[model samples]
Target: MPSKMIVSAASALCLAATLLPAHAQVPTVRIPEAVADWYNAGDKFVQESQKQKVNERKAKNVILFIGDGMGVSTVTAARILEGQMKGKPGEENRLSFETFPNLALSKTYSADQQTSDSAPTMTAMVTGYKAREGQLSVNHTTARGECNADTIARNSVKTILEYAAEAGKATGVVSTARLTHATPAATYSHTSVRDWEADANMPTTSVAGYPCRNAPGAVKDIARQLIEVSPAVRSSLKVAIGGGRTYFLPSVKNGANFFDPEYPTTRGRRADGRDLTQEWVATRGPGAAYAWNKAQFDAINPETTTHLLGLFEPSHVQFEADKAADRAGEPTLTEMTTKALQMLEKERGGYFLHVEGGRIDHAHHNGNAKRALIETVEFSNAIRKAIEMTDPEETLIIVSADHSHTFTIAGYPARGNDILGISKGVPQRDGDGQISDVDSNGLPYTTLGYQNGPGYRAGGRPMLTDAITTQLDFLQEAAIPLGSETHAGEDVAIYAKGPKAHLVRGSMEQNWIFHVMREAFGFN
Candidate 1:
């Protein structure tokens, strides 16, 4: 005898408890087929948009031009010098690459040291890996006389040019230095040493008498590499012009005759017993032609000629200032680039060409700012030509330096002052104040000059003695005992334009350049 209401509540509670397990394990609700279809469609659209974005990033062609040992200060000095020459402000003397939409800072250091040389730095840019100084596109080893037994033999990496060629893109390499020089060599050759010119497999005894001590291999030579080995390189090279005729000519040749200066002489003898000029002409095919002088280079018809080889000088081309002063007969860097572009553009697919103002680095080494500035301006002109010829949308252009020089500007002076001379604002009250009585060229009275480092002098000015200015003046001062201006351990600027150039941001390692180029060309 429980109460009737209590008994009913108990029964209801038991019934609810029975359904709790089922409710707790309930399944998720299912959407209708139409709603499911809508979601799928939206996801597809998003994926397609992403795909389009990636396609737009790949550039059809790329051109990278490096000014070895050029840094921010170098650019500033070059700009000021160009402006002064043109009677304009420094801001008005913008370089061709200055038009780029993206800029980045690049760390220039070797694997072994903070400061870098051209060889390893160029290798890093081209190969996407760091290398020790003086080493080329390979690893260093302590073993001696161990042919094919180094770490380089084990690591097989692909070059940007090789990848581009595999993708059916055209490529070319050009430089004011020997075409086989470090920067250009990084594109197609690989070895443990940068100086290796002959192939290891080649018979050393046969060519021992010739002065080709650094032959990495037979095809390693600039001429043979472009014409014989690496079919992709040869086929892609529609235009090959620079100033390394000695490497291409016979060793026995008495005199260097760049581009048949006079009528061709058969005095030189190659190992194959072939005339150097004939070998060059043969490589170009029957219709293709060659030139060696300014007049001959000018006379060539880019419209009709399919291939060209223009060697203006026997050794490295003269400095721009020397060339401008009529001390040498050679085409300007701008002229060479213009001609190369004109000839290369005729191909069905666009071309990848490299142009260098190599003499700028040479002048900087000698601490000759006047020569460096002139060479830099000449380099800028070549860049301008490339910009005008190629469309921005289809091409990606980069301007950068391999490293930095120690040269810098110092001293307190008013605007519009000549850098080569002493400061004009020195106080006249005390004997300590030295007036710069010299005019524009920085020639000082008496032999006394500013000290630059140890045993070095800035042949004229006696204004500032800081690290940067001391280095700059030391280069200018003829009496300085130093061999050359030294390179600095500092970051350099990278200017970029065209498709995917927006990716260049913040400071980055020098090897990242190769990655950028790879992604831009869809190599990965």
Candidate 2:
């Protein structure tokens, strides 16, 4: 049997909503789940469930937001935190897009792995193909890191973004991570290895440059491919933004590219003397612009510019919590999303934009749930802003997670308990009399936790007060002590609104998301 703590803690956490509120002003945690509503036999639930059954004609434009590792648990906890911060009864509150007309759950399993990673998850979302782990835009038959020409030619699947572009729709990608990271790269490039961001990151022999020794035409380092990529039927993207400035610069014999305005400590990763940024700028032609700072980026007239390339950091952009303090003045994810939409919307045919809150996964990997929650909060803000900028009638907005993490909202924290705080104030029934059930370690535990991570505290000896437990830097206790927490195999929720939104009602495979977009847009 599992440890009593595991089973008991889970049951107590599930039952926590029935307990009193720790903070008197706020209400108890509402059972937002479907089970309670089903039992209640409420008319509202029935009416809400029945709505959005008819899928409308294809949308003119599509905007998909992928919140990496944003599991249902993360969403629930973040929902509470967002509400509590605003002085509301957290459990009853809703994020901006949570009220979206349609909702469904996505089963996030890859073709080759029970638990998925960003690469294959993104591939599934964009291509409607369940790819193997670490493969982007390639089918399951292709082996990871295989640079064989025949395999590459046979397995590369066409993505929805490419489909939109081929149909004469404008296309753009924005992220808060290196533009070449797995999530964003899946939209534009096909590669077996997720780590090949630049030439320096690729192998000199097997992983050798774009058009590898074995794969003469397909396999290539991500950044090189990004700069050289041209859609098969349409012109290249109208806009691209995010970090990885040094990856585009040529190699320096000594010292880093501190001289580069946007990336001071960023060393050039390309051994070749090619300036890919300038080359990309050249391809964009007369009205094109390349920006490395806020001023340069802001100066670009969105109306006139046909294409804009921005690389603010030498690597991934700072997390949302630290973005405001960026020394190089990087754009926020919302800023990039807004700008890309402003430019792409001007096109006559329509647009497809992929915006990723890419750092949520990063924060979770480091066992920092607070940062992950805040990142999710920021991502919610981005969705609201996108809704404000676009037309619902013509645009299809879908918000979903690439995969989930091993995070949990456990422990019997009282109603409206600080989402980041320890469980307290709930008295559980013990045999004949009630007792403030304390653990063997004689300490109260937390409401939030991880299945396994660096946050593990051996023996669970150290008890925590609300003051320390609620701190932003506090780490939720974990069951195991891995350097990093791993992704979970779970069903992530899909929240959608506007055009073809009705099609997203039932639980479906991860690749079903891409097909929904295609069917909504009436793409063959």
Q: TM-scores across all candidates?
A: 0.73, 0.86
Question: What is the TM-score of candidate 2?
Answer: 0.86
Q: Any idea what lDDT model 2 has?
A: 0.80
lDDT of 2 by residue, 212-287 (tens): 4223444667888787776542264888898878878877644443245654555677766667888887876788
By how many angstroms RMSD does model 2 differ from the true structure? 7.7
Candidate 2 — worst ten consecutive residues by lDDT sum?
Answer: 428-437
Q: Candidate 1's residue-wise lDDT over 1-524, tens digit each?
A: 32223233345445545766653421121111232344565676677656543225568888888887677877877776666667653433567677566799999988887888887888888889888776666644412222342234465356787777766666766677766567776776665555543332233432324223233422233344445545666556666677765555554433553333432542222333234455657766666777777888898888887677766665567777667554336688888888888776776666667776777777777766766777777788888888999888878888898898766665554344444444444444422434544435653322112123232543534544333332433445433456766677789999988777877779989989888888888776
Deviation of model 1 at 69, angstroms: 1.8
**Positional deviation of 276 in candidate 2, in angstroms?**
1.5
Query: What are the lDDT scores of the predictions, listed in order?
Result: 0.64, 0.80
**Candidate 1 TM-score, C-alpha based:** 0.73
Off by over 4 Å in 2: 1-55, 148-151, 207-218, 231-236, 253-260, 427-437, 458-460
